[model samples]
Target: MHMNTYSEATTSQLPIPPTMDEDLENNTEVCDGNNAMTPMVRKKSELVVVANNNSRLQMLRNFMTNLQEVFFGTKLVVLFPAVPLAVVANFYSFGRPWIFAFSLLGLAPLAERVSFLTEQIAYFTGPTVGGLLNATCGNATEMIIALLALHQNKVHVVKLSLLGSILSNLLLVLGSSLLCGGLANLKREQRYDRKQADVNSLLLLLGLLCHLLPLLFKYALGGGDHSIATSTLQLSRASSVVMLLAYAAYIFFQLKTHRKLFDAQEVDDDEEKAVIGFWSAFTWLVGMTLVISLLSEYVVGTIEAASDSWGISVSFISIILLPIVGNAAEHAGSIIFAYKNKLDISLGVAMGSATQISMFVVPLSVVVAWIMGIRMDLDFSLLETGCLAFTIIITAFTLQDGTSHYMKGVILTLCYIVIGACFFVLKTPLIGQSPKASFGVKPSFEAITT
Candidate 1:
């Protein structure tokens, strides 16, 4: 009954034309806007034009925004060169070691600025290219400092700094990130992907093993004979090449084959999302690298005199102070991300950086020293190697469950403090010198003369 009533109402509302010609005439009137059809079509056409204009404007605005993040963002730190430049000038003119020290310290923020630019570029590109860019210049400040130290033939300092970097990342940076994240989300456990952390741990172990083999060959098994020392050097050289190759392969794994396993989820930071072009980021990366290298030269040149003036050992300067300053940028970044509850990115920055330093920076330093005619072997002091191994083992165990807490962070930090204290009193030994005591006892002048 309802259907029949609705049908009758519809039929009554329709004004049926008596002839086909009359119906055709009425349709024409509607199309020409004698009725509502023409007005509706005009409104739709105007809406399309407005939408097109808005889209083009937005694209232009994004381009401008990217330019600012890439270039202008760097201006804050890039412009910081004036301070270092003056310090360097004062050092040369007045011959002040302190001035030279401060000059390099000033470059720290610039190094961080370069890292930020790469991050912005990564945001514009996908994960693979971002990872590539990051891996390439991952530890710019550390690499530059180590290279300068190697240039001055300060092999002991270089090795200690490497151990310092590894320890700092595995313990200090990772610990701080966990603590901050845990505190940020109190009562909620922070978790990361266990598989990714395990793979990184394994790679770090590989690096430790590579360093360990030469030490075992020279000291433990071969009793530090001259012939054995020579072989150890040869082994170290071979291992450096192998480690570099492995580093390349690992890069392939992270950025290509199993990228998704390690890649961070897309974060929603409005600032990071700023549209920076690839060329712009590349230029800044290269430029910042060169500038940091120049500053590193000045810093290493005065390190010894500064150490003497300040009454600090070269080992302490390199091992503790240098790592903190060199990796300051990435370390701060990781902590910030963790505090914001972005654990994936935080973990990636902390762990990925350690792997890069281990697999890339250490080998590159060895190869560079070799090219410079320095017989820098992989014979680390027993204390350095043992502490490194301990740190790696503890870190692996802590991160295995993929869950983190404030207590875990405290434990890791305490481990770092313990190891750092040990290094503080420890003397810098001539690492490649053989047939000494079990620990890193200083080689006698007779040993050097012979």
Candidate 2:
């Protein structure tokens, strides 16, 4: 009876189990909590996706803005359409003259764009390295044309075009800059940094010496001597190596040890802000270089046909028209800067280009030709060499004083005009045995037969 009573007491003290209705309410509350968390997680993921899309959109917008600025920032952009036209004309076998004209128009904007891209890049590379970049790329048009001509075995075109570039920079571009600057600042004396001018002049003289030695070597031995021709070719190749080394040294001096000397010609303070990012500028430069190469090929390929159609001598076309057109952008820039009384920048643009062409591009062309098995030498015919010699001497004298006047500009302009006239009337055959053939070397490459 006691055991039964203890069991009953324990059973009475135990709690009761929950009902089905209470259990249903607890389950619904758990389900509600899970449902609420699902929406929050979904919203968070959607926001992340939206942010990613917005970032992509912003990048696309920036790209388009940069593209528009690159393509439409300049007045010359109007000529950009000519690039496609020329391509179409070439594809359809249109007249060579039409292709030539369109290519030239296309090249104008491209050349200007190249300069713009280089300057944009310079914003990141400091003044010294920027100046080096400018010097390297300033005559990119000429360099491309020369390389194309060399590829075609048109050594004469390469020589004449390079020579023309030097002359144009030294006389036409420099003279125009000086004339405009002197007239604009008639009351104030227009002066430039002589140290820079002197360095350029000395380098130019060294290049002249290299050119002269090859020509003299050929002439010193009687014409039609095979041995002499070979020796002259060897001398030219060796001289090219020396000139290249000298140019490298000049680059070092300008960019490293003597950087301060060129600081005076840095980009203007107002113009320091970059129009595009570093990689953007690099992309444009590479793209423009490729386009310039294509247009240059068209130009070199059809030069003779255009010359024939236009009734102009090939020399006149290569030595007069080509340089003027190829360097149009640089010429304009120098003149504009000079007019603003920034003669140092003007001088750097003009003299630096000339010096680079002489000491760098010309020799580089020779080396490139050598590599291609083309027998291009430094023996510019007596006529061309004489013109180069006179132009350099005159230019050296003009820059010696570091002071510029309108009269000095007038003199240089007149000199260019006279040279242009001489070439216009001169009817030297473009297709001939290599200049070395005159010295009796077996003709390895035809000259300007393209």
Best by lDDT: 2
Score candidate 1 by lDDT: 0.76
The digit string of per-residue lDDT tens for model 2 on 390-441 reads: 9999999998987888898889999999999998887657533434433444
User: Model 1 residue 84 lDDT?
Assistant: 57
Q: Residue 11 in model 2: shift from native, Å?
A: 4.7
Candidate 2, which segments miss by more than 4 Å at Cα? 1-16, 268-271, 431-450
lDDT of 2: 0.87
lDDT of 1 by residue, 1-450 (tens): 999999999999999757988888888887667547667888999999999999999878876776566546643456475555645576567554655666656666766777777776787677667756764566777887888888788887788887788788889988988887888889676777787787788899999899899877766553566787789889998998998998889878877798877665446555545456667667777777777777777777777777778766667777787777677777787888888777777778888888888888898888898899997888776667888889899888898887878888889988988877776675444554423643344443444221
Which 10 successive residues of model 1 have the least lDDT summed?
441-450
Consecutive 10-residue window with the lowest summed lDDT within model 2 = 441-450
